[model samples]
Target: MDTTETLQGILEFIDEHITDNISPEVLAAQAGYSTWHFCRLFQWGTGYSVMAYVRNRRLAFAAYELSSGKRILDISMDYGFGTHSGFSKAFRRYFGCSPGTYRLHAHSNRPFPPSLPGAYKYLIGGIIMEPKFVTLPAIKLAGFAIKTTSVAGENSKAIPAFWNDYMSNGMMEKLHAEKFIKKHDEYGVCFQEDMTTGEFEYVIGVERKDDAEISGEYHVCEVPPATYAVFSSPPSDGANFAAAIQGTWNYIFNEWFPKSGYEYAPNCNDFELYDDRSMPDEGKICDIYIPVVRMQK
Candidate 1:
């Protein structure tokens, strides 16, 4: 088998024996490579060290089990975390919250299995578009804002409803009429997350002109300068536009990040830039800008 197939098999093996004691040496032996060589190959393939990947998978399963109403200690031990304290510490470091808190706002944020080249495609209609990297100046925006959470995928449901209301309630027309508006294009921006509650603020607004006067009713946000990997949704008509956009997002998080050598930049806003191309009769595409920083070695 080639390297891709070998790593895919190893990934499946890791998942199967997640709750058991799994060592790099054991996995190296399984892959028919020396431990030193296997370590390098595994990191190159998965962007995670051998044991780190195992630990993360274990924590993901542990997070899933938290909702089952099982005792925390039992769940920890089942994931091979020997002690509750050890589990809680590792859990906090990886997820930014303790087990109890994550359970209270439980949603599966598990890392999806990586898609090796030629194994599977995550885009809509099998269309693939590579992202372009760009560094942008600070941006200012003014519009409607809503508080949402990732818990139970609340943002997915809440954001669409929020948009529907904005469009139907005359808010969209009112915002565009403002003198402060820099462009007719709209932005759907997700601000940095709150680690404690898994909640964040999302804004649906247009770009604000630099010298424009502020309005009392509008929510304002300023995004600092950053480098971003920008991905465009596959071109689709009005009927399939939303699906196409969602598919690109899935591909970015599930298929790209693990192999991209970059992670989401902290304290920066990621947004969808919807311009004329996003109109029903136009290009029917939206650009997703994700701020990024090189992953630490």
Candidate 2:
């Protein structure tokens, strides 16, 4: 799925703040954008207005709780509704059931009356995302993107090795400084080119500056200037990277992006940033980065 880490982070703020009294201003603060910026982005990114996402998320949790056997009053209060009557009334309207009746009758697999967004759960890979707002200028890269099955399967490590071998043919020193900016991070983009099934592009390389020479050895791509939400990743290891990436994707897919107002990027790049500074002497140190553009409604 086309998932934006920024939108994912925004949804995460919603998840973290769901239990509290969250105004759009508070929610925006959590999202690292001003209320105006956040609201616009939220609306643009997600089809819902800010309040809608909060209510829908609260409702998703409410349904989960009910399915798990939590009391209606409890779900309501946890979601910030203080009165049973009010909660039940809203519940019946949104979910078409009285709380008591829902617990007694609704199947374990289903909860709520109906007419709400899907569910979201916490995950491990995206557990450490701390997103920041940034504005980056246009940059260019030289690489090839082939659709891959899944990173866990095979190509994840192999493609980078391919890039390295390609680079090692002595292309980096020959590539121009003005046209390209080399980044240690790798980019892994996932999006739905079709409904249900998703698409992925994994690219690794340095940015090509304007005057850069394009020898037959390289391919070129461009990333334009736009509002970006950046997140920091935990230090990498053979042990940690897989788990962390999985968690991040799970969080982005299962939790954050859907509610953030942004739809999947038509064609987005999921990033894996590396910090040579953080690399342990034993192996390597790196982080993941996914840049996203707002999905049009």
Candidate 3:
């Protein structure tokens, strides 16, 4: 099958088996790729991770069916969820109310933006993709660090608290990691993981090649050379970063991944292009990069 065929087929299969226990790796394999590979391409083309999309679809369908008179138990079972409460929780996430309440207010505007009637109508986070196909070699680095759970946004207390220390200590004013800076005070370094993916205790740090006399608690990572889809994000007063990231994922998974024959690298950090640099007054600028491996379609 063609790359497009495989991609669309997988989506179709997902829709048909919304209630099945098929694993993500199995789904990716059916698409003719590995688990991580499928995840990347799926996100690249669909603008959401494979699993994220599945969750969205499941809730959307469940909402539809329950409103159309399907029993909650049947609806829950149809989505492969183990119990009605589980289904209800997921449904509330999408509809901003219990399925029962959702059915009552089906025609009303959703209290939650992310769970609105047409919430899934648009893909999440695809702005500023301005992607460029570029290749570069990975290098080594050093910097400050703190360990915290993987969070969808910096809403986690640890990271926000980190900023408290970051500002109080004047770490931002005097960043010792200069080599990573590209242009416009734009540091080549960026965030590399998704917290919502159940990752815990990720380190927030920067890279310094030279002996910058690293202080505080931090570690170093060796970035390998690879091809990437880099997207520029607007500067922020620390808000909307999550939106931009989410939008980028939606665009990649919805529009790019299905069309591209590339797969995602397993067990590696995704990329973030820093555009806002140091000036929040610059109007929120940053870019995101997705790591990829070309597949033989």
Candidate 4:
């Protein structure tokens, strides 16, 4: 099903049940998506979380009722607030005035009701190839590791440089000599996020046999078996390499996932595969793997 179509269905549902208590879980189930995936998609598509969107829509209607001389407590309860006080606090925060004041003198300042745009548009252009779904068996990787914040753009600066450092300092040749090196191909592995703090470890390494001996700064990390959504980059010639790669990621998260009806499999690691077939400076060809599972309907 098209994501915009699914979203439109949800919007119709919301409009029909505006006065009813609505939660993320409720909407997600209605849309046949996992709660986490649904929340992210809702925010991306409409610029608000399910709860925030509902609150804003309700507040707009409540303000309209206030102008109609409806009782404050009735208006509050009608919008799913447990008490008048709770509604009033939220109202004041959102509108910068108490409901009473708004009703009496600030009718002109009522917030416009929230609406969803027909579709989210992307300004960047690229070929967004349909992903090949594959299951990766459990494996271990060993190589240089670095700590990075989950914050946007932090890893952007660090990762490319990490790759360069690894290549220039002879780390590649050193690892290739190990008996346990499973293959000549290299892996860029991202650890599962530590939710409590927005931090994760990024490792650039190669698959190694279980009994592989390791020495010095190199470390090992394990990956569990899982299905993946794999995206391929256009020939990453230096000129368009970064843009092409980043645009592919944008398409996956912004365009593909919402429509794919899949959620990231919890506790699975995501990784990039680069082998002799790739030319980081010239063709820069590589495959990106995202762990995923079908969302329970």
Candidate 5:
């Protein structure tokens, strides 16, 4: 089978076994690819990591069952949720409300977006731009760091709240007063602690002077010299900046990286740059930097 066929098979498997503990190894084997290759293909094809796809589907199913008059706790347990609170939190993130509220207004909106059969359709149909490549020198960054995981869609929720807290806490002025900041732009840098576990440390801060004093409450880290593929979003529309950033990332991973002739550089930093030019409500015009190396032929 070709790539499309393989992906369709995997999707079918997930649909048939929605409640099963579908591990990556099992899915990769069914698709006839190694774990690494399967993950890339699955992510590019579905616009979601394997685990994310499963969780979203399960929640969607729960949404369907909620309107059927089933008890919330029973529905949650049916979908492998160990606790009603856990299920409620996950459901809220997916549907923008608690299960109880969603059931009351069942006609409000579709529980989930349509899952594409394969990546090629959306990737080719979207206007994904070619990124500019730049070699950046080592730079120092200062900000608060939080540990988050990509597993079970946690990072999607945690990272945005991290930025909101950083800005609301007046971190920008504090960094600027120390003269540690450069160009008045903030940076959100992702440091991978363990790729295998999808856990990373995210620092929300500004570029700091090389000799800036470290704070006990905050963090200081150096971004080493590397070649980066830089992607820029269209000018901010003064509304919903987070969603726009999320869209840009979906295009990058699903559409760009697979075709760009480069793979992510191992053990390096990936970051987003935002500046004063950005609107508080809408979000700043942003540039995303991903360290990369030439794809081995």
Candidate 6:
């Protein structure tokens, strides 16, 4: 059989035996190739090591099973995680939330088997745009903060709601009215507080002077100086602006980071800057800044 057909057959085999122990050696035997040769071929065609693809598939199935309301511990063991803690860790890393949180907030469908060759490109979005690199000075921001987790995309829902509340409930005006405010431009900053839990603090605020006075009611955060890769969301109107921005974020994490030759800088902040271009009209746009360092060879 040809490469495509061989890969498809292996995919089917994996689905059939997902909960069973799967290894590259076994799959290599099934594909009639040496283990090393099979592994290289698999990664080249799928953009994932054989085990990573298998683990992701298993996690996808585990996510779908969450909807059944089974006990998390039992389900974890059923999926070969061996323990609740192990399962939770893997689940949080892969799906961006704990299995329990995912159960409450999201329902996952059975993962579709990817077509061979270039399949990973379509996993998130097909388009990847070039980003402009910049070095930014330290920034001081004073604003409201909400604790949120990336679990089950909770951040995705909470942030928008937070913005709506901020904009509509006079918080936006109140902050803009502050004498300490340096500019009308707003920033949505995400600070990773607990990587183990995928929890972070998200701040919605305007930049302030370094020496500006701050109030007790407003939370203050200072972003350290760092080099950033800035990405502009595709031009979009008011109606689809949120989706466009979310899409760009998905592209950055899923598509760009893997190929960018850079990784997220340690203990740094990533943020979205909203300026006049973000006005609720045609051609609305915003910039996303991610602190980055060159990947070690």
Q: Which structure among the candidates has the greatest lDDT?
A: 1
Write one digit per residue (lDDT tens) for candidate 6, span 232-293.
99888898888888778766754566567676686678899999999968988989998888
Instruction: State the C-alpha lDDT per candidate.
Output: 0.81, 0.54, 0.58, 0.75, 0.73, 0.80
RMSD of each: 9.4, 13.8, 7.9, 7.4, 7.2, 9.7
Better model by lDDT: candidate 5 vs candidate 6: 6
User: Model 1 off-target regions past 4 Å?
Assistant: 1-121
Q: Candidate 6, clashing residue pairs?
A: 96-151, 97-151
Clashes of 6: 2
Could you tally the backbone clashes for each prediction? 0, 26, 43, 1, 1, 2
How close to the true structure is residue 55 of candidate 6, measured as C-alpha lDDT? 75
lDDT of 5 by residue, 90-116 (tens): 999888899999889773333434545
Locate the minimum summed-lDDT window of 10 residues in model 1.
35-44
Q: What lDDT is obtained when candidate 2 is compared to the true structure?
A: 0.54
Better candidate by lDDT, 3 or 6: 6
In angstroms, give how far residue 37 of model 4 lies from its true place. Answer: 3.6
Q: Tell me the lDDT of model 1 at 9.
A: 88
2 or 6, greater by TM-score:
6
Put the candidates in lDDT order, highest first. Answer: 1, 6, 4, 5, 3, 2
Tens digits of per-residue lDDT, candidate 4, 65-125, equal 8988789999999999889999999899778899999988866444443455555444244
Model 4 segments more than 4 A misplaced = 1-126
**Distance from true position, residue 66, model 1, in Å?**
13
Q: Which 10-residue span in candidate 4 carries the lowest summed lDDT?
A: 119-128
Candidate 3's displacement at residue 187, Å, is: 6.0
Tens digits of per-residue lDDT for model 1 on 1-297? 656788888998888888888988899889776554455456546656677778888999899889889999999999999999999999999899999999998767554565677554445777656799999999888999999865445777899999999999999999998889887889999775544344679999888999889878999988889999999998888877888888887677656765677776766778999988897764599999988887656
